[model samples]
Target chain A: MKNFEQRLQRLEYLADRIKEPDLPIEEAMKVFEEGMTLSKGLRKELESLQGKVEMITNGPDDQGGPDMVPFQEVKE
Target chain B: MHLKKPHVDAIVIAMGFPAKEKAAADSSPLLTVSELTSLIKGNLEASFPDVTVEGEISNAKLASSGHFYFSLKDENSIIQAVMFKSKLAALGFAPSDGLRVRAHGAISVYAQRGQYQLIVQSLRKAGTGDILAMLEERKRLLASQGYFDAERKKALPRFPGRVAIVTSPTGAAIHDILNVLGRRNSAIDIVILPAPVQGAEAAPAIAKRIEQANRLDIADVIVVCRGGGSLEDLLPFSETVVVKAIAASRIPVISAVGHEIDWALSDFAADLRAPTPSAAAELVAESREVLLRELDQFQAVLESTMRSKLDALGASLEVFSPELVKARFEILSLPIVNRLDDAHEALVNSIKGLLADLDHWIALACSIIETASPQAVLKRGFSIVRRVGKTQAVSASAGQAAASRGGNEIVRSSTGLEPGEHLHISFAEGSALADVREVNE
Candidate 1:
């Protein structure tokens, strides 16, 4: 799936181009509506993130040795 | 306290350079003890002047006056050295026992103590071949291969949706990177490729992670980081494997190792070098945060832009309305209306002038009428005459005056009336019948 960054970049680009001084008010309104819609949708998607930090585990011989190392914060 | 030995007083005058028994008084040109001491001091100073000697230091101490006193010695020989406060302050590194260094100064004698010493001017580390040089050499060798070339450095994506952190799982670097990523934006997918960042395995492990991230295409960028440590601990970051791995990464690699002073070879090879692990996380996450901020700004711009457009439309709409046309018509007609008022006032004044002229003409006409009217003659006792029954034009011939239709007409001339003809005569006050009029002739 195309990531949110690309979508967000496209939305930002449309928003920028819509601000041209010479653009007709009618056309500007149309673009503004699209940008606002995209922003709302993208923000909603970002807020509803479901994935957490998933440790990749190997199957079969799940010895669980030092294969996948869990992150630790060294205070130094 | 160690006891001072008395063997020095026991003599050695026989063993001294003079050899008193062999040299007769006239043959040796007998010299005083002070003269002998001065001669020895001058010869020693001249012979060993401006010499550079390398030795390990011992009994190093700094006095209250900031002078450094130490003994420079090797296995067999020992020399007392003193560096005054000025030169000691200029020494970049600290001095202590067991540190080997080269001391450069003139060998001079302290006449008061009667002891010879090295007045050390400058001291430097005796580093003919050490880690500092080894590291530099490795860096130079790698750099020659364009491993650290600016052209080889890849530009990081402006908004990386996926990131892989290549660092010790047991290190603060991973936590810092994840914390920064989560705080700025959790939308990015983080793949923590755990690896050692210290010890012998650190270099190879870090290299493996970078290769894995590239092969799997698991991330848009890779971050290699470790906490601050001594040069010995951070050595892995400078290893050829780590440096070469960073240089060969398909995805941009960011190296953040140790504190401000610690620069790993990986730093030079990576796309960007951050001074600290936390700083590296901040640097990599900065673009996404910037994007978010810019998105908010553009949203505001979009709103304001739409609002202004609507406002402008409303303003332009008002221009074409009936009320505006009416208002404009009133404004446009103002000067014409004012001009007409002025003209009306001028017309009234001119009419008044014409009326005044008419009043003068009327007086003249009234005087002429007064002169022609018979009322003035009547007042002067004059009488008017008319034919009794003529209303038609008065007969010019006197003979036809009797044949006229019956209407009163005045006899205009005396020739129209005979002396015996009946005629109506009227004074200004009354009428009478009588008429004897004779032609004046």
Candidate 2:
């Protein structure tokens, strides 16, 4: 029932938390499960927007484009 | 008071004059034991620099001044050791009784009580009860130079294109990593940067792998790992060279050496530290089931979201459908429609006006053409007499004089020719050829 943006944010937080070194096993598993849910949601959104997919080159800032790229040969 | 006894013994002493002469020589200006001890202490201080001693700590106490007073003992003997507050602060771990320690400091005698003791400058716990103690020491030393700060830790790529593993190729560590990676995710390209994991070559070889990985740009993230070991076996990870190599790596490094309880200095310095080889592999590549489930869930959510939006828009469209509101729309647009009809009528009227103007212009053009017609000129009794075999009109003008003078010309001249050679005459009624004998004007 979570909105896409909200769910994606939660997933990113879960990813970050689980990525820590000393995270407790139980907490990590919880995060892993939550991250799974969030990741699934995000992936669904990504695939749905596949037709509108534009190659986004991550830079130091948020300046990205949905335009031509050499590596854009990757299929949807 | 002893002269009587001395006099009786003197006779006996007189027999040993040589012994008496030796005694006199030995008794001349001899030093007291205290002075001699002081002289030896001064000389010891002047000769030897500070040295380290490894022994078990006993009778340890922290004084009010924060200086530590402890006695270091071997099995047979013990020596007094005092570490001043300044030096004691540098100790990463707390010092306690019965703990074996390696203390570095100068050996000096207490001048007041005259006891030789080791003045500890620094102390480190020896013999590895907690490997983390030594690791903490090394970690502190390296961390102060910014080796393990969170800011320096690199983030691992979500979907790494290539992963280079710096571990023993023969050991279970690599097998575990490879097995996990293959089982979890086989999409990544892996390169084995095999290196020794024990003995003298281990640290250097591990460092070499890190360097080679960087040089080749072979991987997005490098996993420097090995199996668990004792404190001695794990020393390679604690080496400055290996930790520095991990710190200096161009690619992000994942340290997966030793078991969860066994932490090496490289663990702190690396971009990330996995508890074990298999754990590191799992970190690098999530389980296939998880990824697939994630993808499926994402697909469903995305579909549902997009579908909901579409449905909502469709509902709104149905509520405001043009077909349902056509009568109302027509009524609302009645004024505009009437205006448009009036505009159309005006446009037609304007077009009719344009057509009338075009007709007037055409009639005027026809009248002008009729007035300028050559037949009209002929109706006005102006004949266009033309020459035979030529399209030029015969006229009484000066330019036609040459044709008029020619007697055998295709058209006859109005004046008679006084020539017997040839003559031609032409009028509106007919054309004739005649000969003239006499001159005529």
Candidate 3:
């Protein structure tokens, strides 16, 4: 989410800039294309992000806590 | 070590109190009051040099010498005890009436007062004290150290990529948090860092887990939480070590220690505080739907804004004439025409033919419009028919009969018309009157 949040903010800024008036045609095209690319990027990110819960055992030499396991089954 | 009653009796006898030493006054030796008191003190002190006693504190008084004097009593017996200022100060807490305490001291007597007492060497709360006040003092100390400052708190990740929970693995807090996060389908990675949530060792374990989470650097935010419990049970979260650990966390921390009414020190020190574990989970990880909605908004805003920009850019060009653009193309083609002399002539002839074709289409459009024009139709011998004055409109068989009786009505058909009915006939040039002589049906 940290990455997602920062990228979303940047995308919003670019989208706003694309609507800036008096922009040269060439420059507007560049900004517009960038916005479209970012829009696709966000969608791709959304498609890939499925909620996952993992647990790490706290022990010495834990290898950066990467011994990840899903959280216990969710109760109703 | 505990001495049996008979063994204590043996020590007392050795200290010069014989079991059957009573004799006639005339034969018995006389002893001074101080001597008897010293003898009793020695016997008692030697028998119980160090003993631990538990009883409710009564008549508690702090003397001018900074000594704490109190009477500890059970249902049957009471013992006066005094703790020197050194031991009292080391307690780091005040003792008051009605508090049960465990006092450790030696049993002796004051020779001057000729009374027995216990010399208190150390004191501890046996069962209960003002827990709230103690918690407040600790809270104040930590607050002064700026551990609970709003500035020290980190902004929770609006979209947390990973969440770490520092709590007992089996406690209801974990289950509650899991339920909430699960219900929302938070598209975030979660790691449960197991820690004790209650009891004497809970504080240290909780603080240690927070440190581990930080050292691991795996979570974007941390939720330190537990389910509802008694104030005493929640004491660990209020411990200074736990509060400081939450403050020092490199990742954002959300503390949810107990039910809504409980406000632990950890809550104050955390980046965010929720009343319950479930609420903390909800606060830390936004739902997948919410993220999708935000993404959708950005895309929608981008599309609509792009459309409007394009529309504005095309506004000026919308009025340009197509024929003028083609003429400009012809002018620009001259250099190519000059490069190929023979082809230039043929090109000119083809362009001429294209112009002729365009002229023919233009003429055809004009003639089509003229044919549909009312005035042009009229010039070609067409006229309009309309009823004038009082007349019958031959729209229907019944309408003819009804108009013939005496009513003036519009006539579209000559159903039941009598000869010599007046009409208004209009051509493109002028209008005139006419009579219907025959019926056409």
Candidate 4:
């Protein structure tokens, strides 16, 4: 998600730069291409629908990572 | 001392009338005032050893010793109560005047004041009104400490990787949060810090779990949540421990306690307050659809910006096309070209006029030359005369004929001729060679 946000921000910046009246054509073209690439990548990521629903039931690992497992709903 | 019966009887008979008769009539022993008071105190203490009394508190004061002295009163009756400093320190809420409470204590007699009062060991707000008052007091205190200051509130992470929920494992709050999160964004890692959402142990357990979550430093945000319940059921959320924990947390806290209408102190102290547990989950992670929409909008904007830039470039390229440039150049240079043409025409006309003037002058010069010509003068019957010698030497020379042909000098007047000088005269049609026979002046 953080990566996505950063990419989106970069895309926005590129878009803004492309709008500059005096920007060199070569630089504008490069920025526009980069913006397109980031936009496509973000869109693909959003479309992939990749995620996990994990629950941390124990303390963090020695490396300070969560000890997570797939969450199972307990029905009452 | 051994003759006490006779002496006492004698003293009593002297001091009061019918002492024996009164004692016999009452069928009881006579007791002093201090002894009777002590007997009553023992009886009262024994009767109400550990009683729980409910009433509104009045005249509540916290003495310098930290003990709380108050009167518990109902509609018609009131009882003096005292909660020692030690017990008062353990209380979750402040005891104040007019707050209804249930106090558990032992009834003891104040022998000095001759009054019976309750020695309270524990105290609790008895109803919603008193609970609200206690919560209000706590809110005021925490507020003064800047616990709920907007400046102190941490902003929630826009995208939280991990979210720790401090809620009951078996309550509806957990299930609702999980469901909402699962539906919206399953990417978030959930840590369930299970604690009782109700009852006496709930507040501390919740606070401990919040602290543990912070200690671990794993979650980007913490959510303290509970499902809808009555005010009494939601009291734990309003507890000072829980509120303080929420206030002091480094990680941003989202409080979603009870229903939308139920307000808890945790709600005020937390960085954000959600109306429901599900709402908190939603706040933690944006839905995939929403993110997709945002991405699409961004892409559209980026593409449009690039397209407009390309269009502008195309427009400039069109403006600079070769044919268009030539046409514009011509248009821009039209006045200068016209001026040059006019200048060229004027120059040609002036030159022609100058040549014509030169032609007239040449004609006048040619006529003057024809009139001044020697042939024309000769044709007018005039004769040319010349002396065939050097003026510096008057004598005839041997090369005279040669000098006559090559170096003859013309005489402007007869007086200029010398006597005996050889002369050559030429008419327009013929020539003559002669000698000056006489002196002429």
TM-score, each model?
0.52, 0.41, 0.51, 0.59
Candidate 4 per-residue lDDT, tens place, B314-432, comes to: 99799999999999999999999999999999999999999999999999999999999988999999977777643334333433454456676677878767676777666787666
Q: Write the per-residue lDDT of candidate 1 for residues A1-75, one digit (tens) a residue.
A: 457767777787887788788889778878998889887776666556542443333221233332344434455
lDDT of 2 by residue, B411-441 (tens): 3354644445334344444344344466545
Best by TM-score: 4
Q: iRMSD (Å) of candidate 4?
A: 3.4
lDDT of 1 by residue, B329-402 (tens): 88999899999999999999999999999998899899999988988888789876666532333333342343
Candidates sorted by TM-score, descending order?
4, 1, 3, 2
Q: Which of the predicted structures, 2 or 4, would earn the higher lDDT when compared with the native?
A: 4
* Candidate 4 off by > 4 Å: A1-49, A59-65, B1-140, B168-171, B185-189, B194-205, B228-235, B261-263, B285-335, B390-406, B416-420
Can you write out model 3's per-residue Cα lDDT over B1-441, one digit (the tens) per residue?
A: 244444544544678786576444344445576766677887777888999999988999999999988899999999998888988888845777766788888987888887778898888777535786788889888889899888887887667777888888788898988788778766667788877788998988888888888887878888999987666778899999999889889999999987776678998999889989988887765545576677677777767877777787688776566877787777888777677887878899999999999999999999999888978988899765545443444344334344345444555677666567666555788655677777667
Q: What lDDT does candidate 2 reach at residue B384?
A: 42
Give the TM-score (vs. native) of candidate 4. Answer: 0.59
lDDT of 1 at B207: 86
The DockQ of predicted model 1 stands at 0.21
Every candidate's fraction of true contacts kept comes to: 0.31, 0.04, 0.58, 0.44
